[model samples]
Target: MGGGAWKRGGSSCRPTTTAVGEPVVLPTVTVEDVRRVGLPPSTANLQPAGGHVVLNVPVNVYAQAAPVTRQVEVLGFPVTIRATPEAFTWTFGDGGALGPTADPGAPYPAMSTTHTYTRPGTYPITLTTTYSAEYAIAGLPFQPVDGTVDVSAPAATVTAHEGTTVLVR
Candidate 1:
C-alpha cells in the first residue's frame, strides 16, 4: 500500500487541501455523469434529400455538432458539465463504416465524409458521436473528464438506385 491521498471507491471527485489546512472538494464528472445529463445526439443527414442516391456514387454524410452543458449534483455538490463532440463514426449499413475521427463532415461542395454503395438497395445510415466532457464546480476552472461518451443518432434509411445508360438525341 502506498502512502498518499486516499480516495473513496467509485467517487470521481478529488479532495484537495488549501494552504491553510482547509480541505476543498471538487467534483469530478465521469462518463456516466455526462450520460445522466441527457445530452442530445447529433442529427444525421444525407445529401439529395428523400434518402435517394445513385448507385456506385459517393454519397455525402454529415452530423450536426454542438456542445451541451447542464447542472447536476455530484457528491452533494452542484456541478456543471459540458459535453462536446470530439469524434464520429458512420455506419453505412453494408458492412461498411467510417472511423472514429474528429471530422464531423460537411455538405456538398465540401464532402468531408462520404461513402459509395456498390449495389442498389435500401440501407440505413447511422452516426455515432463521441463526446468529451469538462466539469466546473464553485466558480473554479473546468476540469477534463477522464473518459468519453458515445451516443448514436436515430438511423436514417437511404435507397440506392441503379441507373441504366440511355441513348440521347
Candidate 2:
C-alpha cells in the first residue's frame, strides 16, 4: 500500500476497511456537514413585477440556483465538498405549492413553473432548494454524500388583484 497511500506531513496514510474488505472512508461526508458549510440559498424570482399579479391568472416563478464548493478538514484529512442544486420546492403562500422538481422554472413566456391565484389578495412566496453533495479527500476521487440538504430562500410578497369592468361611450 506504500505506492497508493497518501503522504501527510511525514507519514503515510491509507483508508481503513471493514472485515468484508470494503473501504471505510473515515469521517464520511454527511448532509449535516454540507449544511454546516452554509451554502447560499437560491433566490425566488417572479414575473409580472411590482409584487402584483392579476387574479385567476398564471404567474411565472423561478429560482436563481447556484452551486457551492468548499474545503474542509475531516479527521485531519483535507476534504473538498461540492453541493449542487438538485431539486426545488415552492409555496405560493395561498395554500398552493409546487415542488421538489428538477426544473427551477423560468421567466415570462417559458412558464416552466406557474401558479394561478383564484382570488384577489396578498401572498408570500417561498422557495426551498435541495442540494446533493459529493466530497473528495486529499485530491482523491469524489464520493457521493448520503442524503441531501435543503436551504430556504428569502420570502417574497405578491399581491393578486381582480380587474374591474369599465364602460366607454
Instruction: State each model's CA lDDT, in order.
Output: 0.82, 0.83
Pick the TM-score winner: 1
lDDT of 2 by residue, 28-142 (tens): 6766767776688898899888899998778999999988899877678789999999999999988999988999998879998999998889999999999999988778888
| TM-score of every prediction relative to native | 0.83, 0.81
In model 1, which runs have C-alpha deviations exceeding 4 angstroms?
1-22, 165-169
List of clashing residue pairs for candidate 2: none
Q: Judged by lDDT against the true structure, how good is candidate 2?
A: 0.83
Against the hidden true structure, what lDDT does model 1 obtain? 0.82
